[model samples]
Target: MRARSTVLAACAAAVALLPAGCGGGEKADDAGASASPGAASAAPGPIPAIKPADVKPLVGRWVGTAKDYFQFTADGSGVWVRGGQRLWSGTAIPEGGGKYRFSWQGGDLKTASYWGVSLTEKNTKLLFAGTNQTYTKAVAHKGKGKG
Candidate 1:
């Protein structure tokens, strides 16, 4: 009877330590392993779609500066400059294919014309071309009188 009680006490002590030794780490590892696959399979929400009709009316005059550059326009033709050097002066025309193309004289150099197409939105898109001292810039047409 005495030996049986000693054995039972030893077993109880082992069982108590069992949870402390194995419970926390194994449970955390299993949770982390299972959680990773679930995170990977989760889908991101839908992307916003833009159509040509949505951008048509924006084919007028827009004047705003971006990235420390300034633009001034009358009608669809405009000039852009940065740091007191003229970059380009160009005409913008809607190309009927959800895009607008602009042609302009690049810098003070005659016979140097640059052209590019851009999709219009409530926001403007600015494009930069060339390296170092040689570059061209294009902006989307923004509409109406200034606010």
Candidate 2:
């Protein structure tokens, strides 16, 4: 249980620093917005089905904050990095129909934790089902045209 708590703490810290990343300066929506105090809010619309092509485009670094991010490689591997250190890595498998299953091996677990994941906002953001966290893709820059 201690291991789970540590992992949860890492995720919490990542969310707590979201206002300062590649997210375009917009405030993050409340993680638990459904429970926010106000007139009852409508449920969010259904997420679009993930496509097989969507898997390839996920091969890059996605950031929630300067110190927290997820990186995926074309070799079907993904890593979660925090505080400039790699925290864990796992296999990313396509379950077809644009859905992906991530089986990560880390911490105290003898088995892997599998989670459904998908891309949103035109593939600019990564969203994991059953969770409110979102990570924005890091934009790549090219060198200035040679003189």
Please list all clashing residue pairs in model 1, or write none if there are none.
Answer: none
Question: TM-scores for all candidates?
Answer: 0.31, 0.52
Q: Which candidate has the highest lDDT of all? A: 2
**lDDT for each candidate structure:** 0.33, 0.52
For model 1, how does the per-residue alpha-carbon lDDT over 41-143 read when each residue is reduced to its tens digit? Answer: 3222221233434444444433323222324233444444444544434444444543433332211111111233343343354332221111223445578
Residue-wise lDDT of candidate 2 within 7-69, one digit each (tens)? 566576544533232221112244433321111343222233334455687888888643567
Residue pairs in steric clash, candidate 2?
50-98, 51-98
Q: Model 1: how far is 84 from its true place, Å? A: 1.7
Clashes of 1: 0
